[model samples]
Target: MANFIKPYNDDPFVGHLATPITSSAVTRAILQNLPAYRFGLTPLLRGLEIGLAHGYFFIGPFAKLGPLRDSDVGLLAGFMSTIGFIVILTIGLTIYGAATFGQEKSSGNPNDLQTKKAWDEFKGGFFVGACGSAGFAFICLSSIPTFTV
Candidate 1:
């Protein structure tokens, strides 16, 4: 029978407070899997690459325009970080769904349960990258001096 439920190992800490850690683990598992890795790479790399690109393009232009307020910086960083995460989750989930469909189609057994597991892991991977990015952005943005001039 297909296990429709997403497994999170029944750990309270993992279930409540540490989604990023779970996400990273899922991402790692997906990456380690030879077949799924190829499909997963697009979004994984995209999050990092686009985040860097956005920072480079927007920061300099904004700086050149004038001195930015801390709020402005926070808003910009948060927006970009959020967008990057959105991209990661959207793309990752799409790929995961497609892969799951493919797996189901290829198998003769209609009761295959691994498909659900794969989906859960992919969700975790996406969450992991998104959380990591958000945390990093928060820390970096928070450190900026809120100089009230």
Candidate 2:
């Protein structure tokens, strides 16, 4: 029998998480599976690329103004709204992921004390901080041109 975590087509009911199982763990797993030469290039990279592109396109120069700024007021408003949404969700998920996985591995797993301590420290490390940061950048960049005109 397949695990409940891995969704299946036959039953078609047990969906994935309301969001994705995204964390540094998923990114780390991909890193471990890849060749050293491909260190920074991965599916995660492509996804980030697409996300940045989408954000850019949404708030791009062309979209913000073309003559009838009145007609585009709604689109501009929505772009800012989603950027805010993604940013807020990113922060919430960061806190939740840190608490959930940090406790699971370090607090009670009977692993080596140093190992657990290191994990406890690293759970809120640089990459995790960067996730929140990227969201912030997106929110800022996505809202920048829209508000000025």
Candidate 3:
């Protein structure tokens, strides 16, 4: 019949072949949509902040004592340890933040659960980072014992 004959363009086989979407493509799409600052630099910045504070705290004591031993190596190690802890903390916090706060679609919708979750994550991250950094510093100090103060 004349009605049964479809146009060539309407034929399924004649259409353009689309690229199949894979799991990797979907993951890339999600990552691309996320805010770079929140997902990437926030953690690193937080770690750097902690490291700077630790360095400042040591400055006074280091200045008071005259260097006789391997202060340079010890200091470098201590700083590196602090930086490492910060990296760990930042990663933990970023993952937590992404899971907890990232689901909210609108700033206008104020939900108490979101607030509580954020608070809990913040406290947890602080403790984890602090404990890790302290433990690392203790190990480094015990091993090196460079500062007289």
Candidate 4:
């Protein structure tokens, strides 16, 4: 049987966290065969998954907090909040990445190169995921007419 859970030693992000596991054998097998996973794009894929879920589920609650509770206005607020979140996250991650990058460069470890590459991919994936999901949500939500002619 193929291992569904990634080994902790192989996953730098697994610190203090449970190893990732597919819920079923079929899902694990299918995902394992995907080019994205093969190419180490799991971070990007995970980011997209997280962003899409956040956009769908949190937007409504955010919209509720908008002034007058108008649908269009609420949606606009939600969209803006999404943008703001992306910006903030980007800045924070950039700082974290920079610090890690410097440490990895100085560590003199043979595996640092691979770690750096993975970190770069993770950052790119996170940015793309946030932007893509936010853009999609904006397009979908903005199409709803606030007032009928």
Candidate 5:
């Protein structure tokens, strides 16, 4: 009993998670563990790269326009609508990330952002952040006619 128990306890999360592992399963596991840059470096780089792209997209308009027209309701609304998307999305992601990393997003506290084991989930969040910026910018650009003379 102890002999089998030791092997079973090796990795509580993964060991015996599946059994009767097949030839293709072995091949797939080998492929996933392959030391290729595509699987390893790319995900890391892509997450940071997409984050940078989103940050630039967020900052570009502010630097050019000096500041958004907060006093003017129309421009303010549009501008807020534009940036609000980014802010909320970023905050939401931070919340989720913190949760995954076992931390809190509130309390005005300094954060230690730890990447979770779920790379796929992180990638999805990164993509959503980028796409939200793009979509909000597109909406703001398209709605300009009504705001202008």
Candidate 6:
């Protein structure tokens, strides 16, 4: 029927073909709708993405090192690295957030709402980023054959 064909007929590629071989509409529809960030999901998701990427790149060379060559030692390194990363990021973000958002109306007053909010956001992002990186790094490192093997 004309109605059935109209949808395909409207498409440039499909119109020229006897049958619609591929459906661009389906792809277009999916591309249009994506998940929106609500609450603090953005930082968490970003951290995971960044951490995975970091892990992917980090595992290779580090795994080959002397102490890290052992799976147990490597895992410990990963944990240590994660902890260190988290601490560094926390301190740096806290300082940055405080300086940027914690402008005290009165010179001597130190506590404020904005600074707390900024720190919370940074905390969410970096915590995931560091943990994710370490987890992925360890997983990848474990798979490799060590010198003992």
Best model per lDDT: 4
How would you encode candidate 6's per-residue C-alpha lDDT over 1-149 as one tens digit per residue? 44334445466564453233244667556644432222334444544554555545554454455366656676567456556656676678677767776754333212222445534554566566666676766766567675753
- For each candidate, what TM-score against the reference? 0.34, 0.29, 0.30, 0.53, 0.30, 0.45
| Candidate 3 deviant stretches above 4 angstroms | 1-72, 109-149
Clashes of each: 1, 0, 0, 0, 0, 0
Error (Å) of candidate 5 at residue 30 is 22
lDDT digits (tens) for residues 2-102 of candidate 5: 43343333577655632344324675687666432234444434555565467437544643354543444534454455456566766776567666766
- Local distance difference test, each candidate: 0.49, 0.45, 0.47, 0.60, 0.50, 0.54
Best by TM-score: 4
lDDT of 3 by residue, 51-147 (tens): 4445334422432342523555545455455556555655776677677766555333122224434434444445455545555654556675445
Q: Name the weakest run of 10 consecutive residues (lDDT summed) in model 4.
A: 105-114
Q: Look at candidate 2 and give me any clashing residue pairs.
A: none
Looking at model 2, residue 43 earns an lDDT score of 31
lDDT of 5: 0.50
Total clashes in model 1, counting residue pairs 3 or more apart in sequence or in different chains: 1
Task: Give the range where candidate 6 is weakest over 10 consecutive residues by summed lDDT.
Answer: 105-114
Best-to-worst order by TM-score is 4, 6, 1, 3, 5, 2
On the 0 to 100 scale, the lDDT of residue 121 in model 1 is 45
Error of 5 at 20 (Å): 28
Worst 10 residues of 5 by lDDT: 104-113
Q: Write the per-residue lDDT of candidate 1 for residues 31-61, one digit (tens) a residue.
A: 6664333343543353444344333333333
Residue 62 C-alpha lDDT in model 5: 46
Q: List the candidate 5 regions with Cα displacement exceeding 4 Å.
A: 1-45, 48-76, 103-149
Candidate 2: tens digits of C-alpha lDDT, residues 25-105: 686588665432243443334334434444444333323453434574645454555455445644664575566555554
Off by over 4 Å in 1: 1-88, 91-116, 146-149
